[model samples]
Target: MNVRSARGAAARLAGRKGEIWAAIWLMARGYRILGFRLKTPQAEIDLLAKRGPILAVVEVKRRASLGAALEAVGHDQRQRLRRAGVTLAARRPSLAGASVRLDLMALAPGKLPRHIPDAWKGE
Candidate 1:
């Protein structure tokens, strides 16, 4: 493989590792993982979790710093998450009454994952 392809592969592998680490962290914290890489026409939610009556749509952003990671999830991403959550609720009527929330999971190298619950309000 060329240099560019090798770098891309490495990056992709790193991201997958980060996602796995994040999922493990969440599981240890008692959050039951419902889905991963949930994709719709509008957007993709990295993880879907359930803790009691709360349904959390999680966006995982892994970077060297929290600022850089959090910045990755911009306005467009938030809107897509909202739409995806709505679609999830529509498809699963059981989740209709559950409290839906947008959560940001920021993972920085050598740092504990930051779980920002209710990171955004559907506005």
Candidate 2:
């Protein structure tokens, strides 16, 4: 395989692994997972979860460091996530009326996953 394709595959595998870990962490903390790798016309949501009245739209990142993982989600990505969240909520009756929040789950090797709720404010 070409170097680029191999790298892409590795990255995707790592991302999916990170999402799984994040989901497990959330579930242990009483969050019910609603969706994983949900794709909207606006963008892709890595994870969607709920706890009480809040609907969490999660972005999972696995990087060399926690700070790098958090920084991986940039301005344009955040905007896309917001749009995707709105689209998903509108289409899913179960998600209706839940207070939507953007969350970041950062996973770095040898460190516990960090869950940052309400990670970003509206743009």
Candidate closest to the true structure, highest TM-score: 2
Flag regions of model 2 displaced more than 4 Å.
none
Of candidate 2, the 10-residue stretch with the lowest lDDT total is: 114-123
Q: Against the true structure, whose lDDT is highest?
A: 2
Please give the range of 10 consecutive residues that has the lowest summed lDDT in model 1.
114-123
Q: What TM-score does each of the candidates earn? A: 0.89, 0.92
Per-residue lDDT, model 2, residue 112, is 96
What does candidate 2's lDDT look like per residue over 1-123, in tens digits? Answer: 999999999989988888999999999999999999998888899999999989899999888887897789998999898888888888889888988889999888898999999887655
Candidate 2: which pairs clash?
A: none
Off by over 4 Å in 1: 121-123
For residues 14-41, write the lDDT of model 1, one tens digit per residue: 7778777778888898888888888888
